[model samples]
Target: MYLAKRLSIQLLVLISVVTQQTTAQPLSNKRLEVSEKHLLTDLITEAISRDEWMDANQLFVSSLQAESIKSGELDNLKLSLGLANMPIDSLDFNQEAMTQLKFSVSQMLPRGDSLALKKETWQQKGQVALVQQYQRAAQIERDVSLTWLAIFEAKQSIALIEANRGLFEQLLEVSQASYSSALGRTSQGDIIKAELELIRLEDRLASLALIEQAKYAQLGHWLGDLESWPEPNSLPQVALKQARFYPADPVHFDDKSHLDNKGHLDEKTQTPNHSITDQTLSKQFVQHPNLIELDEKAQLAQVSMSLAKQAYQPQWGLNASYGYRDDAENGMPRSDFLSLGVTLDMPIFSKTAQDAGVKSKQLALNAIAFEQALALKQMLAKYRVIQSKVAKLNQRHHLYQSSLIPQLKQQEDIFLAAYKSNEGPFSDVIKARIESLNAKIQALVISVALQKQKVEFNYLFATSNDFLLGADLVAPMSSY
Candidate 1:
């Protein structure tokens, strides 16, 4: 009677376990929806729409190309005019205006003094132009650098996920082998259930891993090389030394900023550079030092406008001079003369010359005006909006650091010990494993998001010295 009852109990337990296993359904642990990997490069590449940065980058490159052409043209002009042959000091053949300017100034000043003033102006204008070009190049470099950083992050995520999947696979096999052998000591029902759960987790890991290649492909698209991807552990930790939080209108923060920058990063990009950037004239450029170059543009324009009017003015002068024969006894003055004259010249006002002058000034004014307007608009509208959204992310930082990580760690410990015993229902162990994995991924998502925000914050608010690290607004390689 006792042996029959024990056999009946075992049979009933096995049947109930099988029914539960069949009904519970295997849960694949894939992380769906959006996460930081998207922000890293995939989404940013899309959100960063190739507009102004592309245009500005192209503008800087074209500026260089245009400069080369201008340099060639100026050299040609000097050859044609015979101006290059004479030293700048040599006013060998002056136009009516230049002649009058020299003569008039001569009475009050030495010839060297007149030449020095005009020469200084010309050299200074050229200097400003060179400086502007350098800054533009620096800014373009920075844009490419930051965009590529996003690519780096995406690659890192894929590697980490793959590593995690591999670890899970190894662990799954160990758990399965232990379960099959311990079946008598362990409940057969529990062992079978553990086997099934491990299968589900394995499937989940495989699915997640499949996407790793996709992420790798995206990285290759940016860098044109996959093996060149720097090892994940080797990446330099980018630090945010001192972040001066972007102050935004509280009205928008209370209302729209959340809608704009919250929930998803792709949406925040819409705020535009004019909306998101607090691009004060006072705002210094560092990482994207191209902003500094804009000042040089305005400076050059003003100088060119001054130079264009050079032909329009009259110059009057008087000179009292004496020349002595160097070899004469007692250095006797051989010739002495006193001459005074008033010279007046007026521009004939050729529509061509006049029109050229007007057009040049107008174009310079337009460039300065466009850049200024765009910077200001970004600061007031787009950047401010972004700033608010970024702030929200910061507010969540503590929640992750203080609360989530520790709790997940504690759960991992509890589950780890239980699984080793092979005594607990396998479903309990599976639940613990799944929860821990979810928590780990969530932590990564938070970390990646915060890091990305830090990068963007530096990009928006960083000063001129900061850009020294990666400050090429336009890439020289692309230009080449």
Candidate 2:
């Protein structure tokens, strides 16, 4: 009766351990709560607000505004005051000596719309600065999202290992009790194996804890010392913006349709169309802030070239002078003299310098055009690569969800049941449990990877239009 009662207690412990292991579920299935989404948004907003790059860009824009204003008005007008035609001796300061105090003002008129072109160039530069600010914001959003996802992945992985560790501990206790009681098939070897598995779980948890800590440190660059920040509770749901050039079949946060009965993507499943024409991509890229930034730079260069070409025209200056003459020593009144003059400087002798300036500006404009073309091609390539990766990750995630994880769970159950009935080795049961745990962790990894790729894919089409107006980046002048 004592042996029978001891056997019944061991069986109950084994059953409890098996039930706990089998009931463990992956964390990937949990949707990001609304509060969590708001938390992520707030983090992104804080990061952007504190970004020094935005402040630098704003400073540049302000400088450009000052230049635009300077070029638009008579800021270059010159004035002079001096003694003119004064005699060397006081005795010579008579009516015929013509000694006088003179004041003169001269205004150099910019040649052929040059002032307008200069103003336009500065304004275009301001636009580029504004676009760059938007680009910085987009980059910040992507970095923060990726870092947060890394933290989430590490946290989830640690949770899975810890949960499985508890089950392993229970199993270890069962093995030790059974071995001591000389019951079931538990041997000293089984006890050693259970202890080894528990130690491995501990090792894994330590490594993952370090990884989570490192990710938090990286996130601190944007969030500023996460000592007070709560650990991320859920993964943010990265939604792909529906851009016109985006693939027709975008992966969604809850999408499961691509998989078939065999846990594979359906042969008929339409993948992202890699054959999107350059023309279509160009249309989209043209609107992207990156390309728009280059376009503004190119426009600035063109205006600069036009301003340089003005050097070929005559430079004109208008001057007016008023001379107040002192009365003659003999008490005769002296007349106040007014003088007006126009000055012209032709570029006849400066052809070489003028041509060089215009050519340099033209070369810069051409360089900007090449840069823009290269940028477009690079963007297209990146989009295709990210699209393919997202599609493949989706398929892998589905395989784990629809087949691999379920099969592993079943295998674990079969092994546990066999061990319970004395038909399988305890080693098989341990192996099955480890396999199930690893598979769930891998599935969570794939989900995180998929979301990260989607973030990049969406960023390919990110624009400044939404925030540009709000930033008050209007051009200083309407026309050149």
Candidate 3:
């Protein structure tokens, strides 16, 4: 009787497990919705809200300006011997000698007064400080934009991978069923391969998740807190939804329309490429903040040279003294005496030192000029490279959207149908699916690259004078 009860219990447990497995639902891609503008606003607001020491570049510049303004006052004249030298007689010896005292004042002035030069030096230094502040602002904008884009790229990659999960599962189901019966077209090896591919996708998703976390941490450093960031899944879904709306070319295969009923690509009118070329970019290069800063630096160096040359000029001074004395032994009081004198320094002996200083300053000015030219050339070269890269990525985008992706999709469908009809190996279907998925992944990579290139151009061109990073305002890469 006990044996019979055990058998009945085992049967019931087996039935329950099979029921759960059969009813289990496949995992679906999570929707991510994000607004670039909103995210940027939040990030910038948080960055500015914090009163950190590192963010005080502008304040430091203001302080330097105040210092320069205060430098207008020169050094005070020397009051030489204001306290008179008094000579006293011996107390016990009682010599008839009378006490005498003397007082004097003196001042030294430059032959070619360089006070103005010194003041100008301070003013130029203030200008340099202001330029440095602007540079810092630009760097901050660059860093923030790069971090934000990195987060976007990682999220998009993970989403693309997730979107293919259903396809992977469907393939796995076919392979499993075919392998179970020797008469089926697919073998156990194909099932194993499908299983491995699924595992690879999961591994890739995990790696992308870690990368996403790191990017969030970097952004949070600027944002002041991680808690303020939206969920990782939220932004990607919005981006994916937008991508779904993006148009792709219609390909005719076997007299059937493979295009999604929801959207269609317009080949006649290409979507405007949001890339900036050297010719189309602003010709007003003078307004670039970096160039402005370098110009100020050069001015500062020139002023320094002028100040150094002032060392060759002579310096002059004046001195005056007064003496009061008591009467002699005859008791006749002596009148107060006054003396005046003038002093001058030709600086003839120090000509070599002054010349050396002037030469040093001149060299510094020349160095800055060379640096400016070199920097400009380098910047132009970088712009050219970035321009070429953007153009190339644009072409690749079209090729993927209009050709490779469509072809792969058709191949996948054909292989899938062939396997179902027992006319092809399941391995072919798996390969087609992987190839199609890879094309999608490649499309995503190019889109993000194009967007990143756009960001670089915006920064390099100084498209916006405002502190806000304009990269956030740009739309995603255009689609056919």
Candidate 4:
């Protein structure tokens, strides 16, 4: 009996060690150190810097700059030279037949600041490209962060399963030994069940290995070569930024609100206090890069509309010419002629075309406004949904940490002790142990999921410097 108790104690110690190895790191509060060697932020920075799409966008901005420069030079001075022989014979009383050369210079002056408006429109387009680049960078950061977390989760799950495999092996050994010795309620059936469970654990390990490989492939889309990439052994805790419009103390609906005398709920009492409104969400979303990009586009459209309106005014031209004539047929010298003129084109015949252009631009600008509104609505809705998910995951994580995990662990210990003393069926021991392992894995899943949601939530708060990490927004790859 004393020997049996000693064996049971030894088995408990081994089980405890394995469980500690599996759950300790995930449950700890240690933060991963950020450095040049760190994976998460460094990977994000690298991905943004090396992104071909961002490089292409920067080139587009450069093209816009060229367009802006071109717009400014549209009304520059023009010069021309002409050589011709005067046809004096056709005139009734021509004084001479002469070869003439003419030199002329002309300048077009655009009506009503049209040139300036055109330049400004191109400049506004460049600004929009810049905003979109930053927005794309933020999206890349979110994607890399999520993929990294997924790989980490898979690695940790594999570790937990491998750690628990030792306990399962020990159970199989005990069942086989007892059945061979014809001892204490141990049967061939228990041995078979133990073997089956071990096989299942092996199958789980293989599945997790495949999942980890797939995640690595996904990560490679951003990080490039995975050949030298280190397996993720630690999870970096992402800092959660509180949304600008999030209430400090959120409101909840009160089902027990006092009813009016007429049996309807009081309107004033029914209203939840500290509730966030659509206006507040809109105000927050306006600061996001996606919305800001749309805003810039709208401004560009407005400038274009103003430029189109300038087409209604007349365009003016000024020219000066000096013409030289050779000696006439009678061998007499002829005087050179000088001329000056001012010309303008009336828009009387182009009223329909100009109106149509202006109307088209106006409708485009209005369309941008509608796009902004729709995008804001979608962002607000998505934000609310993710916020709810984060809250629920947090609650579940707390329940696992404080109540479910501990109870499962205790139950596992109880069943193992009972099985050793022949007071419980071997199947009960296996069930309890499986439940405990699953609970631990579930807890880890919740933790990883919470962090991923936080990463995504913080991404919604797009500012110029949000994910820039001190890198220049316009030239993100320069430092690299």
Candidate 5:
């Protein structure tokens, strides 16, 4: 029992120490990058949520409903007057006998099915607008994410380049010192080479900085302000251990390749080895917003056709009124009278017009159906290509991470060690370093491109009612 109590106390002490260490640790670049992604996502969704286009669509829907309501009601209703035997005899004392008065009302009513068809068409149109709005919002979010990734990649290049520049500067100093020393083996040519390399690095840094600025400007265009862009610390860290050399390789120290500023390679490639299948993607293709919008349009055209056919039916109306009339041809008290009317507007004379309208609406519906089918075919083809590309790119990214980068890193370390020991030429070390830098840059570029593919894929596949708006702009990344 005594031992157990002592062990418990020891565990408590360990927990306290760990808590203190954790509290003292600074925020990491990974966490800051996540925060920045969240901020961008929030801004994009907010912009979409407040878009004027959405309001315009909503107003249009309201207008359609209003029109339907107005059409369903009586087209004409009025209080009317009737006068007879007025003022024909001049200077007649009995003018009251020459005057007769009555009051009546008349109205015209719309066809019955016309209002119902309008309501149906309105509903279909509203659905189309809603889907279109969701698609537009998704497009905006996708664009913002792409811009964010671009900026992240630009910043990463700048960091890697700047690190290389520092290395070159140190090497330049060493070469200059060795060249000037009496009895030193380093020649004036080595010093000159180092100076030229340093100058080249400086120029490259300036160019990369400009690229970074342009990327930042693109991000700012979406985010609405350059001043509020996240600080450098909030960017993905390009200096992760992944960018460094691997400690294991069988190569000799004397022979290694160094990377240079010009080692930039195009990173765009296809991905490979995803678990999804074409069959699954095909099943989801019909649910795409563009196709769904087309379906809604078809439904609206069908409703229009129905309304046109309805025009062949007679339009009906009624007029009814109560009248107060003076006694006719007698000096007696007035009597009230109630009158009723029924009017029918038969299409017998305009049957051809109604048939023509029906034909037009039917053609419109057929056109919509054809367009929907075409869109489905096109979307399926497009997604299939994208899937193949993404799969190949995935394979390439794996190759870089698991093979190429580690090999280059080993080469850099080998040349670097030999150069420091003065047993190897400085040029060999620069070559190896440049090669290593190129490998790292290649990895970074491909990583960013993969993320972009993910954004686009999600935009295409997403079908949530809220359309997955305001979600994380990027997946949690460990490094740039």
Candidate 6:
């Protein structure tokens, strides 16, 4: 018994110590990142919980029952038959309660009307819930983008390293050959230069290895598994012909307009028009990633207004209770009667608050209008910027493809031929090779940047049709 008690005490002490360490430990930047991720994960999990395919009819029924329980709204009716109208002994509170119940039932939900209205109300609520689902979906998409961006970048860096590896192999062979030829000809200076080249190649390889390790570490953290990481099969090849860009100008975009910004939001703010999908440029407006949420919210605000008006009106419900009172011939009490009743209390006190609530909801609707305007304005600004960038990149791509790149390729070819014929300095051949590598690398970087910009622009401005296909094209192109 003594030993068990001691052990229990030790366990308690250990738990307390652990708790203290957890609470008192200084928060570092690393811990903050972890906390943020956990919060995000939890929010997504909760939002998904609310997204279960609940039956609207059943939920509305349940919600009405819940409201009855919460507000005690149905049980507030009382009997007031007037003191002179009924003698004290003859006044049966139970009879008055029964009459109130009958009146409330016929007035509130009215038996035959409930089923259809219940279904309709919940269906509208479901749309609002679905809007929340879309926002949640967007968050999940953002997470995926973060993870894949890390992986793509990792693969991209690996490809650069692979390219550098090939450079090293060729450099090593040239150095070895130069060293051999120099020693055979008794040329000490050339041998020294070859040794220096070998040393530089080793340094480059080491640096590339470091970069690969860092990228692997980043990917591992995202996946929540330190031991596993993405193993790229091969470096990606660019398919310039498959590129699809978002509209450059959101102010005057058409069906073929590239995604420049989230301009669809303005359509609704300008007009709370029903059938948002049937409006101008209907295809672009239907379930657009950026605007659907706002439009649904506006619809929900209208529902709230309706609910507020309903709150001002009376409601009906039934109640049953059993009670016992002291009423016995032998001076004792016994169980007497089981009472059943229902009520409809006037909204004399509640109408004021209901009015305030309606006004508050109206203000919220106005706020959403302002928010829609802000989103459109910001999107337009973004669209203009991306358009400028896309134009500049296209111009540069054409200039390099047509003029500079072709001349650089010819120069490399001429230098190779001259070197083979022993008519050019070896250093001149090396310079030509370096220039060509730089040009190719620069071109590759710009091409990737163009795609990255397009992906961001498209995500914010894409039409409903610009979905998975857009993702597919942007996916490979996004590997920065």
Listed per model in order, the count of residue pairs whose N, CA or C atoms clash below 3 Å is: 32, 0, 4, 0, 22, 4
Itemize residue pairs with steric clashes in candidate 4.
none
lDDT per residue, candidate 3, 1-480, as tens digits?
A: 533543554454344323323322443222113354355534544453442433465566667667766665655677644324333443321123333466777887754647777777888877776555445555555566667667777777777877887788888886777677676877778888888787777667666666666666666555544443453332221111112322331111111132233223334314333343334333444456787788888998888888888888888888888866657656665677789998888898888899999999999999988987777776667666764565456567777888889989999999989988989988898889888988887887777676566556545644224444221222222110
Query: How well is each residue in 34-60 modelled by candidate 6, as lDDT tens digits?
Result: 342243233223222333332343354
Which lDDT tens digits does candidate 5 get at residues 1-480? 533543554454344323323323354454345464355555456456555666676676667667656554545577788764467556332345535555677776656588777767776666676677667666666776677677677667767877786787787777778777734456777777777766555555555556655655554444443343344334322211111222321111111121112232224322322234446555665666677778788888988898888887788777776655555445566556678998898878887888899999999999988997787677656655555555555556667877788888888788778877777777777777777877887788877776676566555554435354222222222222
Residue pairs clashing in model 6 are 246-258, 246-259, 247-258, 247-259
Task: Indicate the worst ten consecutive residues by lDDT in candidate 3.
Answer: 249-258
Q: Order of candidates by lDDT, top first?
A: 2, 4, 3, 5, 6, 1
Predicted model with the maximum TM-score? 2
In candidate 1, which residue ranges exceed 4 Å CA deviation? Answer: 1-129, 132-167, 170-235, 241-288, 311-356, 379-386, 408-432, 461-480
TM-score of each: 0.45, 0.82, 0.75, 0.79, 0.70, 0.50
Ranking by TM-score: 2, 4, 3, 5, 6, 1
In candidate 4, what are the lDDT values of residues 174-214, reduced to their tens digit?
A: 88888899877888888888878877776676666667667
Lowest-sum lDDT 10-residue window in model 6: 468-477
lDDT of each: 0.44, 0.74, 0.61, 0.73, 0.60, 0.45
Better of 1 and 2 by TM-score: 2
Candidate 6: Cα lDDT at 411: 93
Candidate 6, which segments miss by more than 4 Å at Cα?
A: 1-126, 135-157, 160-286, 314-352, 412-431, 457-480
In candidate 2, how many Å is residue 262 off?
1.4
Per-prediction CA RMSD (Å): 17.5, 9.2, 11.3, 9.3, 14.4, 15.9
What is the Å distance of residue 136 in model 6 from its true position? Answer: 4.7
TM-score of predicted model 1?
A: 0.45
Q: Model 1, 66: alpha-carbon shift in Å?
A: 15
